[model samples]
Each structure stands twice: as structure tokens, then as C-alpha cells.
Target: MAKAICILTGNHTAFGVVFFKSDANGCVTVKGEFTGLTPGKHGLHIHSFGDLTNGWISAGPHYNPNNEMHGAPQDEKRHAGDLGNVDVNEDGLAKLEMEIQHFHLTGIHSVIGRTLMIHQNEDDLGRAGNEESLATGNAGVGVAWGVIGICQSNISEKALEEKSNQ
Candidate 1:
């Protein structure tokens, strides 16, 4: 079965679909939609943990499956959840797409058990200088946040049985 998680942030929103090929193999694709942003760029990433109690606090640090410090998504020493920034037009809207590796839909490392966040500021790729810049400078507050979860499949068992009989 294919699964996905949808998240809505303050500045932008995203939908991620995860297809499992095996226990240890899978693909994650995400598309983001946003409007009414502050203009320029903003930091986007997946938090390590999920907060069922408080949506704001539930989002922990970046998803560092490798236990390394924070870095850009393309950086070799970066966290698994370090996706970098998203640019917003003058109208304050932006769209983005991404494909991720070393993440899963099920099991312990499953991204479905975490939170997605959109920050109000840009990420300097952890090189902004000073403690504030540590791990993208904490980038600004989370303007919007959402928990990840598997979407329900449209095809039901009954529907499949009928199609097979046909």
C-alpha cells in the first residue's frame, strides 16, 4: 500500500507521499503550496519528533537520523530532515517539490511519526554565525505546523474484489 502525510504551515503547506518498496526501501515525495507569506525566503524542514499534546512544542529538532549537527539538505553532514528554504513571490506565495531518501512510512524511522514546520525566516545552512545560527540559526518561529500521518486509501477491499471478478 502507498501512504502519505499532509501538513499545513503558517506561510505554506505541503503534502508528502511515501511508497514502500520493502522493509528498508521506500521513496518520499513532497509538494508544497503557500500564500500570504512575508516575501523573500523561509526555512522549511521536518522535525524529529511529533507532539500530540502541543502542536507547537511537539515539533522537536531536525530529523537527524545520523546524529550529526544540522546542515542543508544537500550537505553531506546534514540531518535527514534538513530540506532548506522555500522562496515566496511578491504576492507571498510559493510552491515546492522534493524527493527524500533514508526515510520511511512505517517502522521506527517513519516520518509519519513526526511534524512538519515552516519558519518565518531563512536558513543560512547552519552558517549564519553565533549561537543563533547554530542549525540554521533557529531560523525564526514556526509560523505554521502540522503532524504527519498516513492517508487512507481510496480503493477498498470490496472494490478490488469486484474488479477481479469482472
Candidate 2:
């Protein structure tokens, strides 16, 4: 499997680690552990850029290569970055795990080097009856953000060399 990881950062104490593991079929499992958030739902998305020079704003918009509308992760016509929301418990901790097909960790649709962001509000999944909802799910400002990077691969160098020679 291909693997990637992100270490979140923000202005506040909210922080976390997100992991992405993908199989050869392009199915990806997203898992994350977060803390120091409000006891409620927060939007989670993948922005187009990894830039953090100017903070979250510099990350660009959602990773919508197809220019699709904002919606849930399972939506057929949604942006690739529309990952929906994560719920925080009363103790300000959230454990998230989901399987997504919109993007993978490797190949053409890979999200590596992009920005993973935690928003300040719950995503309406494009049902909020407003233009912003269609565009951004009204997911407010980003609270935490991180850049996706490749983790150590399980495939050995010999296996990779042999595969390349095939």
C-alpha cells in the first residue's frame, strides 16, 4: 500500500496527525486523531496547494481539479477535497476514519503535497440553500492545516527495481 501523513498546525492549540493509506485499486482509507477542538463538528478538506507561507489562506481553494461543487465525500458530483465533517467529543478530541474514493495517495489523482485543512464550522454538504454552500459548503475559516507528504513505503528497493524492469 502507498502511504502518506500530515502533522497539523494552527494558531490555537488544536493539533493532530492524519494518515492516508491506499491500495493498488485506488481505494484510500483516511484516519486521523485530533485534539483541542470545540465539542462539535468541524469541516475537513484538502486544499489545492501546500503553501503555508501566509497561513491557511495561502493554501488556495479546495482541491477541485474537476471544478465540481462542494458536497459530501460520497457525493458523485462533489469536489475531490470535500471530505465532509469530523465530530469532536466533549473532551475536545476526535478520532476520524473513513474510506474515500475521490482521491488516492499515488498516481494521477494523488493528493500528496496538498494542504489538509480543518475548518471552523460544520460543512453543510451543499444543502445550505446558498451560493456559498454550493461553492464552499459554507465551511468557514480554517482552524488547522498541514501538508500531505509521503511516508516510508512498505515496498522494498529490490521489489521496486524488479517491477521497474518489468
Candidate 3:
């Protein structure tokens, strides 16, 4: 399975981390934990570009290579990056885990080398019936963001080959 990680920061402060791995069936399992955010629900998504030097604005739109509409991860016609929302605790911490079968860490729909942003508001899953909602989910403000990158492995060469040979 392919694996990746994203370390997010907001307003120049340490924010959180997200770990991702692929299942044998090419689906993706995402596990994320965050701190130092407003206490409430926030939208999270993977953007088209990995560049975050400008607070992710340079990242462009969500990763929608398929030209789909904005919707939930399980929606039949949603951007590949639509991850719904994450709820933060009163103490400013949040944790979320989800399995998505529509996209992967590699290939044309790959989320690798993209930007993950945490918005200031919850995503309504494109049910708002507004133009902006269909484009941005009306998820106010981007408080934090990160770049998705490949995670290195610690396995030895011989062990790797032995497993492949099996």
C-alpha cells in the first residue's frame, strides 16, 4: 500500500498532522489529528497543487481531475478532495479517520503532491444549493494548510524483496 503524510501549519504556528495509507483494493484510509484550531467543525480538503508558500492560495481549487462537482467523498459526482469536516474539541484539538474508495495516492486521481486545507467552517456536502457552495462548499476561511508528501519507509532491502517474492 502507498503511504503519505501531511504536516499542517496555520498563521505560522504548528497545527497538526495527517497520515494516509492505501488498502489492498486501492482505496485510501485517512487518519488525522490536529491541535490549535477554533473549537468547532471545519472543512478539510485536498487541493490541486502542493505549494503552500502562500497559505495554500496557490494550491488552486480542490483536486478535481475528474471535473466532478463539489460533494462528499462518497458522492458520485464530487471532487476527489472533498473530505467533509472535522470537529474540534473545546480545547482546540480534533481527530478524524475515514476510508475513501474513490481516489488513491497514485495515478491520475492521486492526491499525492497536493495541498490539504482546513477551512474555518463546516462543509454542507454541497446541499446548500448556492453557486459558491457548489464551488467551495461555502466553507469560510482557510485557517491552516499542508502539502501532501510521500512517507519514507524503514524496511530493509532484503526484507522488501522477500515480501515481494512471497
Quick one: best TM-score, which candidate? 2
For residues 1-166, could you state the per-residue lDDT of candidate 3 as single tens digits?
7888787887664387787888689978888788888898889998899876677688889888888889987788999899999999999999888999877988878888899999888988888999889988988778889888886555433343344336
Q: What are the models' TM-scores? A: 0.75, 0.91, 0.88
Residue 49's lDDT within candidate 1 is 77
User: Where does the lowest 10-residue lDDT sum fall in candidate 3?
Assistant: 156-165
Q: Judging by TM-score, tell me the better candidate of 1 and 3.
A: 3
lDDT of each: 0.66, 0.88, 0.83
Model 2 residue 97 lDDT score: 91
Cα lDDT of model 2 by residue, 1-166, tens digit:
8888888889678887887888777889888888888889999999999999999999999999898989999889999999999999999899999999889887778999999999999999999999999988998998999999997788543443344336
Q: After aligning candidate 2 to the native by TM-score, how far in Å is the CA of 88 from where it should be? A: 0.4
Candidate 1 per-residue lDDT, tens place, 3-92, comes to 554445443442222222222246665655666667888787778777736655667787878787677777778777777888888877
Candidate 2, residue 146: lDDT: 96
